[model samples]
Target: MSTERTTGPALVVQNLTKRFGERTAFSEVSFEVAYGEVFGFLGPNGAGKTTTVRTLGTLIAPTSGAATVAGLPLSADNGVAIRSRIAVMPESPGLYLRLSVAENLSYFAGLYELPDRRARIERALRSVGLEHRADDLCRSLSKGLRQRVGLARALLTDPQVLFLDEPTSGLDPVAAREVHDLIDALRKRGVTIFLTTHRLAEAEQLCDRVGILNTTLRMIGRPDELREQLFSKSIEIRTRAPLADPDEVFAALPGAEGWQRSEDGAYVLSVTDADTAAPAAARALVTAGADLLALTPIRHSLEDVYLQLIDTDVEAQQR
Candidate 1:
């Protein structure tokens, strides 16, 4: 329901770097976020995920390089304009505790100089399912509710780009789920979201693309693309009976790297191509007097890929 112009990418970063005195927070980070896309920024703590967000949101200037957010160049001269078009929800909700939910939102709306401030306030509250609690004092709300208030405040300006830094950090599972749903809804409506979090699963679930940052960018691509780049396709099959010499039997399958029995008793086969290997695996099993119960291609999880990359990087840095 935003009237903001949609042209090309919603955000673009080019070799962006930030530092504080002698310490470098992040360096040479670069990636672009397409309009209406949820771009997830992921890294371990101190990986400069938050620093990158701060730089892009115009909260802090990069030590070098440049970025254009929502078609506006990010610089000191354009900082005010850039800030106006983007809303940032920091890791902490940062709400005025004594103020009521409506009051907190109203204050932010006024800062944006929005016309019909009250209507926008109502809409923001409704968007986050806090309409019923609009009059409740922020101090009395649960942490989850306070987070929702933060989200509503972000919506006050109907920003073209929304930055959410650990939006669900401290909430219970139910509260986290609620926030996830709200984000999903916003994505469906074509709002661009820049999210940074330690939750790889959440990134896998919500982002159209993700960039793994750790002082520098490790990788940037779609979740499935990253998986494919880092792992081989595989297949898993359960048998009505135990596989006879699964290692040797499956090793003969097309592009097979041999097979191992999983803890669940399923034979997991590592192969170069599941498309060509699965059929051959089934045929080989049948010929070997094995009863194939179920055959499923192994899908690489985001966590698996993330850990592998992070561990590899850490080991290399140490060496």
Candidate 2:
């Protein structure tokens, strides 16, 4: 576990803006990731997710705005000083295929000049479940093993902040799950994580608070918070009968908005609150001569929130 250091903000950005030509990738973007926080950045394609990550990683300079990392100004060393305090696992990491796992870690460790280098390397290998393959070359390792090596590379820095950009992208489900387990372990060790992923479900599972940064940040909160914001006190009732016209049935409950049919001709009703709306909906279904088979609250997942935000923006632009 990491020993606690100074109690200050881990990373802070204010009015961060980046632009090129006539287009602006991101503007007026600001957020604070406190120590031990697993902050997530979510957005659709070209919504500036990668651009934002690149700027935060200090790989590129923001057009305007100020950011302080680990209590140091971001420009002192052209971001070098801040970069030293952070480790990054890019979305597509380029690994040295000819180098053994241990060698790869040592190569990075040597650059960072970490103390007790060999011991740190060994500890990181075991931490990511790569102890047995420490001697194997990267080229011969499976995709999952290679990912562990990438993580091991980052761990060599002994950084306070770890930037993971789509850390589990394109891997098999099992490998992705393993990556999540590693993240969980890292969080327990008190490493602040900034995770960016297109995978809404994974982000929902791992992030403490997620910011949907499409064009602008449409929403920022935990998965459950987003659910409550987008679907507060709402429920979907699935019935066995067609109930072709649900408007006449629910005219009294005018707050209900979205109504649709399930694949089996079962109908669904969207309401304000399940606790109150659900019982009334169940009664309404039965009164309408519709066979009520399942009267359960409909859960709006992160994907639902993501899609709604995206579609809502696209629609706004269309208008």
Top of the candidates by TM-score: 1
Q: Residue pairs in steric clash, candidate 2? A: 233-272, 233-273, 234-272
Q: Write the per-residue lDDT of candidate 2 for residues 186-290, one digit (tens) a residue.
A: 988889999989888999899898898865667888889998888755555666656767887776764676666667655566666657777777777788898
Question: Residue 164 of model 1: what lDDT?
Answer: 97
Q: Candidate 2 regions off by >4 Å?
A: 242-267, 280-290, 314-319
Expressed as tens digits, the lDDT of each residue in 66-126 for candidate 1 is 8999889989999989887889999997899999999988888887788989889889989
- Give TM-scores for every candidate, taking all chains together and pairing residue i with residue i: 0.92, 0.86
